[model samples]
Structure formats: structure tokens, C-alpha cells
Target: EADIYQTPRYLVIGTGKKITLECSQTMGHDKMYWYQQDPGMELHLIHYSYGVNSTEKGDLSSESTVSRIRTEHFPLTLESARPSHTSQYLCASSEGGAGEKLFFGSGTQLSVL
Candidate 1:
């Protein structure tokens, strides 16, 4: 089975702070994605990568940035956090084929006060 882990499950930081949401997978999947969602709303794709050194911003525009230096790690960083940036950040990974099953991490709940 695939496994994905996210660090700092719950984070509360003051405005203008810098934070990085960590996400990693043990399944060695080739595709990884990051999504953001509110308490009750549709998920918005914020970033994704096909492989190491291949990163792309998703459909939804975001101020955060992601890096894929290795296969197992994909981290999202927000340089200056704000209240508008508060949301549940979900990390997912899947194989390189179409319709592949996605393994999702528990997610990091971030709150900017």
C-alpha cells in the first residue's frame, strides 16, 4: 500500500509569518500534487510535479511555491502568510499513468491569525 505523510498537522501562526507545509510519500510515485480546500468547499489544485526537478503551478493561482528535488519529497512554502492563506493543504501522489490511484496525506490545517 502507498503511504503519504504531512508534518505539523495543525499550525497556527501570526500574519506575515513564513511557513512550509511538508509532504512526503513512501510509494515512489512519479506524480505528486498539492491541493487547497476550505472547511466546506471544492478542492483547488495549487501545484504539481511529474518528477524530480519538474514542478508546475496548478489551475488555481497561488502565492506559494513547490520544489521537487527528490522523488519522495514535495514541500510547499509560503513566504509571508496571511489570513487569506488559511486553508487545509492536501498532498497527493500517484503513478505516471492515466487514472492512477492517488495516495493522499492526512493534510496540514494551517491557520493565520
Candidate 2:
């Protein structure tokens, strides 16, 4: 098992539904991240943090929003999920600094019909 976790590995839902992708880490790392990937492609940064109580939106266009309440738990919530939001949500984390490798969860594959 990975150090990170994302629930509902696969989900199918109707339009206009609210969904939340859960991500948790046990490493106690201060920097956590959320990314979106298409089937198999490069990682797209959606959200990240510096430390406790430090959250920032990433350099990507995502309708989703995330919150960092604890150092180990970061969750993404979609107020109204749409078909366009259908994709894989990946969570990752690292110790600190630039160029550090990230440990990623298997991911949550969501599909809205």
C-alpha cells in the first residue's frame, strides 16, 4: 500500500452531484499536493501547500477546490460535479524543497453521466 490514500477508486454518478475525493498521508509531510491525470499522462498540478494552515491553488484550470486542515489530510470537493469533471484525481506529498520526489496514491477515477 502507498503512503497516501484516495477513496472511491472508481465512481460513476449522474450530473449535478456533489463529490469529494479524499486524500490522506501518514508520513507527516508538510507539503501535500493534488493532481489530475488523463488515463496516462503527465501530472497536472491542481493544488498544493507549504505547511499547516498553508494552502494554495496550483497552476491549472480546475473547477475543483481543496482544503488543508491537517498536515496529513487534504480533501478535494466539487460542489457540483459535471461530466467535464470526469477524470482521475491523484494525491501526493513530499518532505520539502524543490525537486523532491512525490509519493502518489492510486487515484480516484470519477465519471459523471
Best by lDDT: 1
lDDT of 2 by residue, 50-97 (tens): 787888888888888888888999999999989998888889999984
Error of 1 at 51 (Å): 0.2
Task: Output the number of the TM-score-best candidate.
Answer: 1
Relative to the true structure, how large is the alpha-carbon lDDT of every model? 0.93, 0.87
Candidate 1 global CA lDDT score: 0.93
lDDT score for candidate 2 against the true structure:
0.87
lDDT of 1 by residue, 8-42 (tens): 89999999999999999999998999999897799
